[model samples]
Target: MAEPDWDRMMQAAQAGDADSYRRLLGEVGAWLRRYYHRRLPPAMVDDAVQDTLLAVHEKRHTYDPARPFGAWLGAIARYKWIDRLRAMKSHPSVELDENLPVPGHEEAVSSAVSLERLLAELKPAQADVIRLVKLQGFSIMEASHRTGQTMSLVKVNIHRGLARLSAMIRSRNDAG
Candidate 1:
Protein backbone atom coordinates (compact mmCIF):
# COMPACT_ATOMS: atom_id res chain seq x y z
CA MET A 1 0.00 0.00 0.00
CA ALA A 2 1.16 3.55 -0.71
CA GLU A 3 2.27 5.68 2.25
CA PRO A 4 -0.63 7.78 3.66
CA ASP A 5 -0.52 11.41 2.63
CA TRP A 6 -0.83 13.57 5.80
CA ASP A 7 -2.28 16.62 3.97
CA ARG A 8 -4.85 14.38 2.30
CA MET A 9 -5.71 12.83 5.70
CA MET A 10 -6.16 16.28 7.24
CA GLN A 11 -8.36 17.42 4.34
CA ALA A 12 -10.46 14.27 4.59
CA ALA A 13 -10.76 14.70 8.35
CA GLN A 14 -11.95 18.30 7.89
CA ALA A 15 -14.63 16.93 5.56
CA GLY A 16 -15.85 14.64 8.40
CA ASP A 17 -14.51 11.34 7.03
CA ALA A 18 -14.30 9.03 10.07
CA ASP A 19 -11.52 6.76 8.81
CA SER A 20 -9.35 9.74 7.80
CA TYR A 21 -10.03 11.33 11.22
CA ARG A 22 -8.86 8.20 12.99
CA ARG A 23 -5.82 7.85 10.78
CA LEU A 24 -4.86 11.51 11.27
CA LEU A 25 -5.29 11.21 15.03
CA GLY A 26 -3.17 8.07 15.19
CA GLU A 27 -0.46 9.76 13.12
CA VAL A 28 -0.50 13.06 15.03
CA GLY A 29 -1.12 11.70 18.52
CA ALA A 30 2.58 11.16 19.27
CA TRP A 31 3.50 14.68 18.15
CA LEU A 32 0.62 16.06 20.27
CA ARG A 33 1.86 14.13 23.30
CA ARG A 34 5.34 15.63 22.90
CA TYR A 35 3.82 19.10 22.32
CA TYR A 36 1.73 18.95 25.48
CA HIS A 37 4.51 17.38 27.58
CA ARG A 38 6.77 20.34 26.86
CA ARG A 39 4.16 22.65 28.46
CA LEU A 40 2.20 20.52 30.96
CA PRO A 41 2.99 18.03 33.73
CA PRO A 42 3.53 14.42 32.65
CA ALA A 43 0.40 13.35 34.51
CA MET A 44 -1.69 16.00 32.67
CA VAL A 45 -0.11 15.59 29.20
CA ASP A 46 -2.42 12.82 27.98
CA ASP A 47 -5.61 14.57 29.08
CA ALA A 48 -4.45 17.87 27.61
CA VAL A 49 -3.63 16.16 24.30
CA GLN A 50 -7.04 14.48 24.26
CA ASP A 51 -8.80 17.77 25.06
CA THR A 52 -6.85 19.62 22.34
CA LEU A 53 -7.83 17.03 19.74
CA LEU A 54 -11.43 17.07 20.88
CA ALA A 55 -11.52 20.88 20.74
CA VAL A 56 -10.03 20.73 17.22
CA HIS A 57 -12.77 18.28 16.25
CA GLU A 58 -15.56 20.38 17.81
CA LYS A 59 -14.35 23.71 16.39
CA ARG A 60 -13.30 22.42 12.96
CA HIS A 61 -16.05 24.43 11.30
CA THR A 62 -14.41 27.68 12.44
CA TYR A 63 -11.13 26.68 10.75
CA ASP A 64 -10.29 28.32 7.48
CA PRO A 65 -9.48 25.39 5.22
CA ALA A 66 -7.19 27.73 3.29
CA ARG A 67 -4.88 27.99 6.33
CA PRO A 68 -2.18 25.39 7.06
CA PHE A 69 -3.82 22.63 9.11
CA GLY A 70 -0.80 22.30 11.44
CA ALA A 71 -0.87 26.04 12.24
CA TRP A 72 -4.58 25.87 13.10
CA LEU A 73 -4.03 22.75 15.16
CA GLY A 74 -1.12 24.34 17.00
CA ALA A 75 -3.23 27.40 17.85
CA ILE A 76 -5.96 25.17 19.27
CA ALA A 77 -3.41 23.22 21.32
CA ARG A 78 -1.92 26.45 22.71
CA TYR A 79 -5.34 27.73 23.76
CA LYS A 80 -6.19 24.40 25.37
CA TRP A 81 -2.91 24.51 27.30
CA ILE A 82 -3.78 28.00 28.55
CA ASP A 83 -7.21 26.78 29.64
CA ARG A 84 -5.72 23.84 31.48
CA LEU A 85 -3.18 26.03 33.23
CA ARG A 86 -5.94 28.44 34.29
CA ALA A 87 -8.02 25.56 35.63
CA MET A 88 -5.10 24.15 37.58
CA LYS A 89 -4.21 27.53 39.08
CA SER A 90 -7.80 28.43 40.02
CA HIS A 91 -9.06 28.02 43.61
CA PRO A 92 -12.40 26.25 43.38
CA SER A 93 -13.39 26.85 47.00
CA VAL A 94 -14.66 30.43 46.75
CA GLU A 95 -15.72 32.34 49.88
CA LEU A 96 -19.39 32.93 49.07
CA ASP A 97 -22.24 34.19 51.22
CA GLU A 98 -24.25 30.98 51.75
CA ASN A 99 -26.69 32.66 54.11
CA LEU A 100 -27.40 35.67 51.85
CA PRO A 101 -30.88 35.66 50.34
CA VAL A 102 -31.65 37.06 46.91
CA PRO A 103 -33.33 40.46 47.21
CA GLY A 104 -36.55 41.05 45.24
CA HIS A 105 -36.63 43.68 42.49
CA GLU A 106 -39.05 45.94 44.41
CA GLU A 107 -36.94 45.78 47.54
CA ALA A 108 -33.81 46.57 45.54
CA VAL A 109 -35.45 49.56 43.88
CA SER A 110 -36.78 50.96 47.17
CA SER A 111 -33.39 50.54 48.83
CA ALA A 112 -31.70 52.31 45.91
CA VAL A 113 -34.15 55.25 46.09
CA SER A 114 -33.69 55.59 49.83
CA LEU A 115 -29.92 55.57 49.38
CA GLU A 116 -30.20 58.19 46.63
CA ARG A 117 -32.26 60.51 48.84
CA LEU A 118 -29.84 60.09 51.73
CA LEU A 119 -26.84 60.78 49.48
CA ALA A 120 -28.58 63.88 48.05
CA GLU A 121 -28.78 65.45 51.53
CA LEU A 122 -24.97 65.50 51.90
CA LYS A 123 -22.65 68.25 50.64
CA PRO A 124 -21.30 67.72 47.12
CA ALA A 125 -17.83 66.65 48.27
CA GLN A 126 -19.20 64.20 50.84
CA ALA A 127 -21.75 62.82 48.36
CA ASP A 128 -19.17 62.48 45.62
CA VAL A 129 -16.70 60.66 47.87
CA ILE A 130 -19.36 58.33 49.29
CA ARG A 131 -20.81 57.60 45.85
CA LEU A 132 -17.37 56.89 44.38
CA VAL A 133 -16.16 54.69 47.24
CA LYS A 134 -19.48 53.02 48.22
CA LEU A 135 -22.35 53.34 45.73
CA GLN A 136 -20.24 53.12 42.55
CA GLY A 137 -18.09 50.15 43.61
CA PHE A 138 -14.73 51.96 43.63
CA SER A 139 -11.95 51.02 46.04
CA ILE A 140 -10.71 53.72 48.45
CA MET A 141 -7.46 54.09 46.47
CA GLU A 142 -9.40 54.34 43.23
CA ALA A 143 -11.81 56.93 44.68
CA SER A 144 -8.86 58.96 45.93
CA HIS A 145 -7.15 58.87 42.53
CA ARG A 146 -10.36 59.62 40.59
CA THR A 147 -11.43 62.51 42.81
CA GLY A 148 -7.83 63.80 43.27
CA GLN A 149 -8.54 63.80 47.01
CA THR A 150 -6.31 62.49 49.81
CA MET A 151 -7.10 58.99 51.16
CA SER A 152 -7.64 60.23 54.73
CA LEU A 153 -10.07 62.97 53.53
CA VAL A 154 -11.96 60.49 51.33
CA LYS A 155 -12.31 58.02 54.27
CA VAL A 156 -13.44 60.78 56.66
CA ASN A 157 -16.01 62.14 54.16
CA ILE A 158 -17.42 58.68 53.44
CA HIS A 159 -17.63 57.81 57.18
CA ARG A 160 -19.42 61.04 58.17
CA GLY A 161 -21.66 60.97 55.08
CA LEU A 162 -22.73 57.38 55.77
CA ALA A 163 -23.30 58.09 59.51
CA ARG A 164 -25.49 61.12 58.74
CA LEU A 165 -27.37 59.16 56.05
CA SER A 166 -27.93 56.27 58.49
CA ALA A 167 -29.27 58.57 61.21
CA MET A 168 -31.58 60.24 58.66
CA ILE A 169 -32.80 56.88 57.36
CA ARG A 170 -33.46 55.64 60.93
CA SER A 171 -35.38 58.87 61.84
CA ARG A 172 -37.45 58.60 58.64
CA ASN A 173 -38.27 54.95 59.37
CA ASP A 174 -39.29 55.82 62.95
CA ALA A 175 -41.58 58.66 61.80
CA GLY A 176 -43.26 56.53 59.16
Candidate 2:
Protein backbone atom coordinates (compact mmCIF):
# COMPACT_ATOMS: atom_id res chain seq x y z
CA MET A 1 0.00 0.00 0.00
CA ALA A 2 1.13 3.56 -0.70
CA GLU A 3 2.06 5.84 2.16
CA PRO A 4 -0.71 8.08 3.48
CA ASP A 5 -0.51 11.67 2.32
CA TRP A 6 -0.83 14.18 5.18
CA ASP A 7 -2.29 17.08 3.23
CA ARG A 8 -4.73 14.91 1.32
CA MET A 9 -5.87 13.29 4.53
CA MET A 10 -6.27 16.70 6.16
CA GLN A 11 -8.30 18.00 3.24
CA ALA A 12 -10.49 14.95 3.37
CA ALA A 13 -10.92 15.38 7.09
CA GLN A 14 -12.00 18.97 6.55
CA ALA A 15 -14.58 17.77 4.06
CA GLY A 16 -16.13 15.63 6.83
CA ASP A 17 -14.54 12.31 6.16
CA ALA A 18 -14.58 10.73 9.58
CA ASP A 19 -12.26 7.87 8.65
CA SER A 20 -9.72 10.23 7.21
CA TYR A 21 -9.92 12.49 10.21
CA ARG A 22 -9.43 9.59 12.56
CA ARG A 23 -6.44 8.28 10.68
CA LEU A 24 -4.90 11.71 10.47
CA LEU A 25 -5.33 12.36 14.17
CA GLY A 26 -3.93 8.99 15.08
CA GLU A 27 -0.85 9.70 13.00
CA VAL A 28 -0.61 13.17 14.45
CA GLY A 29 -0.80 11.81 17.98
CA ALA A 30 2.11 9.54 17.29
CA TRP A 31 4.06 12.37 15.74
CA LEU A 32 3.36 14.59 18.71
CA ARG A 33 4.52 11.96 21.14
CA ARG A 34 7.79 11.60 19.32
CA TYR A 35 8.22 15.36 19.15
CA TYR A 36 7.58 15.86 22.83
CA HIS A 37 9.23 12.73 24.19
CA ARG A 38 12.66 14.23 24.43
CA ARG A 39 11.52 17.57 25.75
CA LEU A 40 9.12 16.35 28.42
CA PRO A 41 9.25 13.80 31.18
CA PRO A 42 7.60 10.45 30.46
CA ALA A 43 4.56 11.45 32.50
CA MET A 44 4.28 14.81 30.75
CA VAL A 45 4.84 13.56 27.21
CA ASP A 46 1.42 11.96 27.05
CA ASP A 47 -0.23 15.16 28.16
CA ALA A 48 1.70 17.16 25.62
CA VAL A 49 0.81 14.73 22.88
CA GLN A 50 -2.84 14.84 23.85
CA ASP A 51 -2.74 18.61 23.98
CA THR A 52 -1.26 18.90 20.49
CA LEU A 53 -3.74 16.43 19.10
CA LEU A 54 -6.62 18.32 20.66
CA ALA A 55 -5.31 21.56 19.25
CA VAL A 56 -5.02 20.03 15.81
CA HIS A 57 -8.52 18.62 16.03
CA GLU A 58 -9.85 22.04 16.97
CA LYS A 59 -7.87 23.90 14.29
CA ARG A 60 -8.00 21.41 11.42
CA HIS A 61 -10.35 23.66 9.50
CA THR A 62 -7.74 26.37 9.38
CA TYR A 63 -5.22 24.25 7.53
CA ASP A 64 -4.62 25.89 4.19
CA PRO A 65 -4.16 23.22 1.52
CA ALA A 66 -1.63 25.46 -0.17
CA ARG A 67 0.58 25.37 2.92
CA PRO A 68 2.68 22.46 4.07
CA PHE A 69 0.75 20.30 6.51
CA GLY A 70 3.81 19.43 8.54
CA ALA A 71 4.50 23.07 9.27
CA TRP A 72 0.98 23.64 10.49
CA LEU A 73 1.19 20.62 12.72
CA GLY A 74 4.60 21.72 13.93
CA ALA A 75 3.30 25.14 14.87
CA ILE A 76 0.58 23.61 16.99
CA ALA A 77 2.95 21.14 18.54
CA ARG A 78 5.42 23.89 19.39
CA TYR A 79 2.72 26.03 20.94
CA LYS A 80 1.46 23.12 23.04
CA TRP A 81 4.94 22.19 24.08
CA ILE A 82 5.66 25.74 25.21
CA ASP A 83 2.43 25.81 27.16
CA ARG A 84 3.49 22.61 28.92
CA LEU A 85 6.84 24.13 29.82
CA ARG A 86 5.11 27.14 31.28
CA ALA A 87 2.75 24.98 33.25
CA MET A 88 5.64 23.02 34.69
CA LYS A 89 7.15 26.13 36.25
CA SER A 90 7.44 25.90 40.05
CA HIS A 91 8.88 29.30 40.83
CA PRO A 92 6.42 32.09 41.41
CA SER A 93 7.16 35.76 41.68
CA VAL A 94 4.29 36.36 44.09
CA GLU A 95 2.39 34.02 46.38
CA LEU A 96 -1.33 33.55 45.72
CA ASP A 97 -2.24 33.54 49.41
CA GLU A 98 -2.81 37.30 49.47
CA ASN A 99 -6.48 37.81 48.74
CA LEU A 100 -6.73 41.55 48.38
CA PRO A 101 -10.01 43.12 47.35
CA VAL A 102 -9.80 45.15 44.18
CA PRO A 103 -12.30 47.90 43.42
CA GLY A 104 -14.83 47.06 40.67
CA HIS A 105 -13.66 43.48 40.32
CA GLU A 106 -17.19 42.18 40.58
CA GLU A 107 -18.45 44.78 38.14
CA ALA A 108 -15.68 43.94 35.70
CA VAL A 109 -16.50 40.24 35.89
CA SER A 110 -20.21 40.91 35.37
CA SER A 111 -19.51 43.16 32.40
CA ALA A 112 -17.19 40.57 30.91
CA VAL A 113 -19.88 37.90 31.21
CA SER A 114 -22.40 40.26 29.60
CA LEU A 115 -20.03 40.87 26.70
CA GLU A 116 -19.56 37.12 26.31
CA ARG A 117 -23.32 36.68 26.14
CA LEU A 118 -23.52 39.34 23.44
CA LEU A 119 -20.87 37.45 21.50
CA ALA A 120 -22.86 34.25 21.90
CA GLU A 121 -25.77 35.86 20.09
CA LEU A 122 -23.78 35.73 16.86
CA LYS A 123 -23.51 32.65 14.67
CA PRO A 124 -21.17 30.06 16.13
CA ALA A 125 -18.45 30.78 13.61
CA GLN A 126 -18.85 34.52 13.89
CA ALA A 127 -18.93 34.42 17.67
CA ASP A 128 -15.74 32.37 17.82
CA VAL A 129 -13.93 34.70 15.43
CA ILE A 130 -15.02 37.79 17.31
CA ARG A 131 -14.12 36.37 20.70
CA LEU A 132 -10.68 35.25 19.57
CA VAL A 133 -9.69 38.22 17.46
CA LYS A 134 -11.50 41.14 19.08
CA LEU A 135 -11.78 40.11 22.74
CA GLN A 136 -8.79 37.82 23.22
CA GLY A 137 -6.34 39.91 21.18
CA PHE A 138 -5.29 36.91 19.14
CA SER A 139 -3.62 37.56 15.81
CA ILE A 140 -5.36 36.39 12.67
CA MET A 141 -3.02 33.42 12.36
CA GLU A 142 -3.42 32.58 16.02
CA ALA A 143 -7.19 32.79 15.75
CA SER A 144 -7.01 30.62 12.70
CA HIS A 145 -4.99 28.14 14.71
CA ARG A 146 -7.49 28.02 17.52
CA THR A 147 -10.72 28.14 15.52
CA GLY A 148 -9.64 26.43 12.28
CA GLN A 149 -10.98 29.22 10.10
CA THR A 150 -9.39 30.39 6.90
CA MET A 151 -7.93 33.90 6.93
CA SER A 152 -10.64 35.30 4.69
CA LEU A 153 -13.38 33.52 6.62
CA VAL A 154 -12.03 34.89 9.88
CA LYS A 155 -11.89 38.46 8.51
CA VAL A 156 -15.34 38.29 6.98
CA ASN A 157 -16.93 36.85 10.10
CA ILE A 158 -15.37 39.54 12.25
CA HIS A 159 -16.62 42.28 9.94
CA ARG A 160 -20.15 40.95 9.66
CA GLY A 161 -20.39 40.10 13.34
CA LEU A 162 -19.19 43.56 14.34
CA ALA A 163 -21.67 45.22 12.02
CA ARG A 164 -24.51 43.18 13.43
CA LEU A 165 -23.40 43.97 16.95
CA SER A 166 -23.27 47.67 16.16
CA ALA A 167 -26.78 47.60 14.77
CA MET A 168 -28.03 45.76 17.83
CA ILE A 169 -26.40 48.27 20.15
CA ARG A 170 -27.86 51.16 18.18
CA SER A 171 -31.33 49.69 18.42
CA ARG A 172 -30.90 49.14 22.13
CA ASN A 173 -29.72 52.72 22.66
CA ASP A 174 -32.57 54.14 20.59
CA ALA A 175 -35.08 52.15 22.57
CA GLY A 176 -33.53 53.20 25.88
Error of 2 at 148 (Å): 49
Per-candidate clash tally: 0, 1
* TM-score result, candidate 2: 0.49
Global CA lDDT of candidate 2, please? 0.65
lDDT tens readout by residue for model 2, 79-127: 6655654453321111221222354344444545655766788899988
Best by lDDT: 2
My TM-score estimates for the predictions, one after another, are: 0.47, 0.49
RMSD to native, candidate 1: 22.0
- lDDT score, residue 82, model 1? 55
